[model samples]
Target: MTTLLTPDELEAALRTIGAERYHNLHPFHKALHGGRLTRGQIQAWALNRYYYQASIPAKDATLLARLPTPELRREWRRRLIDHDGTEPGTGGVARWLKLTEGLGLDTAYVQSLDGLLPGTRFAVDAYVHFVRDKSVLEAIASSLTELFSPTIISERVSGMLRNYSFITEETLAYFAPRLTQAPQDSAFALAYVKEHARTVEQQQAVINALKFKCGVLWSMLDELDYAYVAPGHIPPGSFRPQDDR
Candidate 1:
């Protein structure tokens, strides 16, 4: 059987999970931000990550649909607009495409999502389902990964700019908004979890939810590393390195 923890203890446990399991610690991330990746590796990173970026609005909408009150729904609706945009050529998804375009990936094929690794789709989809099926508290808790996102974003933007001549600030602008948005969203999520998780069981569930989310993010990178880096197994029909082309 599991025991409930006090709110402060719960917070500490969540931090511990971030310290140990966050994608920032993954070797693929280290290679990415450390400038060790080839151009093909960078492309693989962006292509896989598009799956994660594209799914955010759908998952946010699912949570919004589940909210009981108009106020919460209104607050959550901003996330959808932020990702999907008020119009074309705007918002997070479009900005992400800019990153892909800058990387020389064809916008049509990228948007088609026909180029994604199988594991990338599976992991990102699992995150959306987690948000939909869990308690509201746990759903909100899962987003706390954003609490840890700003640092990784910083590392990615700075590292790419310094190491890769092909990368430009405009290409990386997708992260600029995320730097602000993630902290704002995470603050709300963290506070929500801290306040609503009154019992130990609820608090533990929130902690577990964050851990599960970290695994989701981490697993995507693992898949990328395995398929793009180690043996460089380019899955059938997926993007292949120029040398392989």
Candidate 2:
């Protein structure tokens, strides 16, 4: 925007962006949650998503290093801990592996990222690079998507549980913590952006940062839908869901 917005107005604008651009609105997400996706499609989703989950601590650590104060650093540190946990076999990333294993994917294969779609790698890497390279304001702004995540988590957990027999609550445990974590994380980010992004240029940059993150997420799903949902476009060497049989 060319004009300076009040904090509430800026928050409204950010929420408006979420309402319009969040990946929860993506067609692939719709199918996945609505039970329209096949086992293979779901496997591909879980497999590709592992890359994003695994990279989150790296993303948070980049931004955490840039924070100016102990408070900010401590706040962001919780994110690192959240994803990495105090030790192995704990944290969000490990929980995500459990999810992939629940989908019958081998833990080593998911960790190796051997079958990751190029699109997944590109989009997720772009997100990390964005955090590493951008202004701290923009970096913080990108995380505003967390504001909208809880609702989608609710939809996803409920829908998947009801529709898919293979997907039990235990399999989806990763999301349980995220329902609370996302709101807390986004509340901090939302306040930070509203307070820090005071000028027109800064405000617009924040808006654009959120839009960029949304695009990153949306693009990942787009690749999944194109490669898996739309028929035979799975890229060469990407995971081929039980083709051995």
Per-residue lDDT over 1-245 for candidate 2, one digit per residue giving the tens place of the 0 to 100 score: 57799999999999999999999999999999998977878989999999999999999999998989999999999999999999879999999999999988989999999999999999999999999999999999999999999999999999999988889999999999999999999999999999999899999999999999999999999999988876659999898988311
Residue 59, model 2, lDDT? 96
Tell me which residue pairs clash in candidate 1: 4-200
In order, candidate lDDTs are: 0.87, 0.93
Give the range where candidate 1 is weakest over 10 consecutive residues by summed lDDT. Answer: 236-245
The C-alpha TM-scores of every prediction are 0.95, 0.98
Tens-digit lDDT track of model 1 for 104-212: 8898988898989998999999999998999988998999888888899998889989988888999998999898888888887777787788886787788789989
